[model samples]
Target: MATGSPRPAVLRERVAGLMAGTLTLPLGGCRAALLDPQGPVGAAEKTILLNALAIMLAIVVPTILATLGFAWWFRASNTRARYRPQWVYSGRVELVTWSIPILVILFLGGLTWVGSHDLDPARPLKSTQPAVTVEVVSLDWKWLFIYPDQGVASVNQLVVPAGAPLRLKLTSASVMNTFFVPQLGSMIYTMNGMSGQLYLQADKPGVYAGQSSHFSGDGFSGMQFDVRAVPATDFKTWIDRTKAAGPALDEQAYGALSKQSTDVAPYTYRAVSPGLYEDIVQQHLPPAPGPVAAQPASQVAPVKKAS
Candidate 1:
């Protein structure tokens, strides 16, 4: 395969190999998903996580070392060590113990407050590059990505410009699921009949792994997808190519695609039905009854809406 090509399996293996050499740990193999991020959002999130760990470790590490040192200093064999039977409640020790933890807590709290807002998924990224909006529907064991502007759709594959921001409007077509692109940042739940928003940006051209982090049903294990970030020119070329050769995504085709399944391969559509995503959301609810004409107040009893 070409080095600059969009080959998912090959790229995954390469990332895994890089992790093996650079990030080997005692616990298990390196997790490229969380540790090796590919975008600004993911990098920021990783920094927050590492900062929290370091803040806690500042106290934990010193406490552990002090415990060991004290054990050796107060050992029974150390006859020269001072021993006082009445020694208790030293003001210096109390001050040190309380002050260190209080400082640590204050620092962590500040960091959390700032990081949470900075990484808010609903917030749009600050950039001069244009943003691409994708409508994502989480199915039983698959993912559907619809590009309204391009009037095309894809299954289990999301392609976007490398430098342009990606705005995702997501909802579940069936049960609750999560839309996660680990290398691009946080995961958010996709609940039935409700929509969620997430913004992501890829810093360079590459392919990243995406999956449904939340388990839904029997085929949950295979609910995986690929995110391909290419150059702006290439992205436009891809859209044109799909429009020329991909299949049409009509209502019947969508109905068949939304059913429960596993390990589906990626495919594209040249066109999609208008308001298809809204239709999918509406399908989860019971159909609304036809409007009833107004009647005389004395002849008809009043009806109350369901709570």
Candidate 2:
């Protein structure tokens, strides 16, 4: 006789083990950034995410179980299984399937609507302390953060006072990009020739990871920055230290800085040229040559206008 297949129990055990490993493989590499948020905004977002997941799982888990239950109950070897050849859909089944989905939609819609308005990036955070204004410019492979209030600027790093709100005014020096600090929540876009506002605050002193979430070019993988949230005194000291040294960020300096480069080290500018940020937004300062290679005059495609 030919060799028989493995016993059904052994096959089931191997399949179960494989399924377990498959389900857990991705989790091993996952970071709980959203779940372990460090700011109030991030916390609120976490709540929304968990709530949505719970709502979805209410139906999902039951449906999965019902599927398995049906499969087993209707299996060929089950002697007591119902075999109604002309059975139609039952009213109870229709009611359950329709009602659950409708309820899920309403819950999800209401949650999203409330969260969107409440967490509007433009809306200022409520704080007794004044908000710090930081001008952000996304370049080809780096981030430029200008602290207009402090009269200082930094490349590839952002420093803010913990417990105080931050009002971020963002734009891009080249193609459009997104500015995101995962622990602080709210990933807003930085567009060329346009400004966007975002408000975030760190609940405690810590270093958070920030990056350009929108891919722009080859150096996109290395486009990351650090957000340092320090105490108020420390923040003031940093400003003073930064001001006492480093070169001023005049138009000429900015011009050189705008050139495409990757993995740039963090550096500070003691002073920023007056109206530089405004000029960039108003197109007085020409936008950077983006990542795209220069094409020959005859080969360049003509720009099109939408109707």
Candidate 3:
């Protein structure tokens, strides 16, 4: 009775001071970027994800709890246990087991279909400010980001103006890869002969990590970068620094640069060939005959459909 049993000694475990908080939802730094989204598309996607998660957990949580509770209750020692020796399914219970999960699946499928379509990476973000286009080339194990507008380029580091919409035109020179900037947007794939796009914006100024989620071998573990969100004016300074540090990247040089490799450090370039992205988009490599001029209607053969 002495002082309420001398209060249990306060014991604490330090994990770099990042002690986990909450059992259900752990503490996170930029959770707002995901759940408290800044745009309609993000909000919709986040809603669908959350709802789907909750719906699944609705079943999972109860099942796990029931399993544990039933395990203990049905133990041989408990005289209160109602042993079912000749058990048969009840129509009502069966109906519930089937219909409930079916209904939940249908709802989840509907939400996924709608959200995925609406948040299609290729779909343009509806906003007053035009997106800042950045062409991304996935290298051996590095990221090459080209700021076409600013006529600058960099490796492993990308900077964008805060509040400005940004789009990435992504592709890989060799194996496939997934570009994921956790706090900015969802992951999108990059593959040879195919291009993908990801739209994003940073609500506030900060440095966020961007990584290649998919493994691409040797240097896959090191295939990560920094996404620097800064003020518009600061972006200019960044450009100048890039320009001062790196020589111009030309088509011929780019060809050599694009070769497979990984674990590269940040590099920058002051200038690049104009329309380089368009060329790359169309699979046009220098000295490879610009791009096949679009076939004119007259030169194209029109075939009739068979009945």
**Best TM-score among the predictions, by candidate number:** 2
Best by lDDT: 2
Ranking by TM-score: 2, 1, 3
Worst 10 residues of 1 by lDDT: 284-293
Candidate 2: tens digits of C-alpha lDDT, residues 51-142: 99999999999999999999999999999997999998899989999999999999999999999999999999999999999999999789
For model 3, how does the per-residue alpha-carbon lDDT over 1-307 read when each residue is reduced to its tens digit?
A: 3555333333334432344545325545446546655444556667777899998888778779988998999999999999888998799979977887897798889888887887788887777867899999877768888898889888899998877788889887667888987666678998776778888777678887888989777678999999888988898788888777667888877877766565788878889889776676666863222112355568757898999
Off by over 4 Å in 3: 1-46, 65-84, 240-245, 286-307
Q: What tens-digit string does per-residue lDDT give for candidate 1 at 1-307?
A: 4457758998899988998877656545356688888888999999998999999999999999999999999999999899999997899999999999999999999998999999999999988998899999888688899999999999999999998889999988778889999999989999778888999999999999999988777778888999999999999999999999867988878777776678989999999988888877777332222123456568766798899
Deviation from native of the Cα of residue 305 in model 1, angstroms: 58
TM-score of candidate 1 versus the correct structure, residues matched by position: 0.82
Candidate that beats the other on lDDT, 1 or 3, i.e. the better one: 1
User: What lDDT does each candidate get?
Assistant: 0.87, 0.93, 0.77
Which pairs of residues clash in candidate 3, taking residues 3 or more apart in a chain or in different chains?
Answer: 140-261, 141-262
> Which of the predicted structures, 1 or 2, would earn the higher TM-score when compared with the native?
2
The count of residue-pair clashes in candidate 3 stands at 2
Q: Give each prediction's root-mean-square deviation over alpha carbons.
A: 14.4, 7.9, 13.8
- TM-score: the better of candidates 2 and 3: 2
Model 1 score (lDDT): 0.87
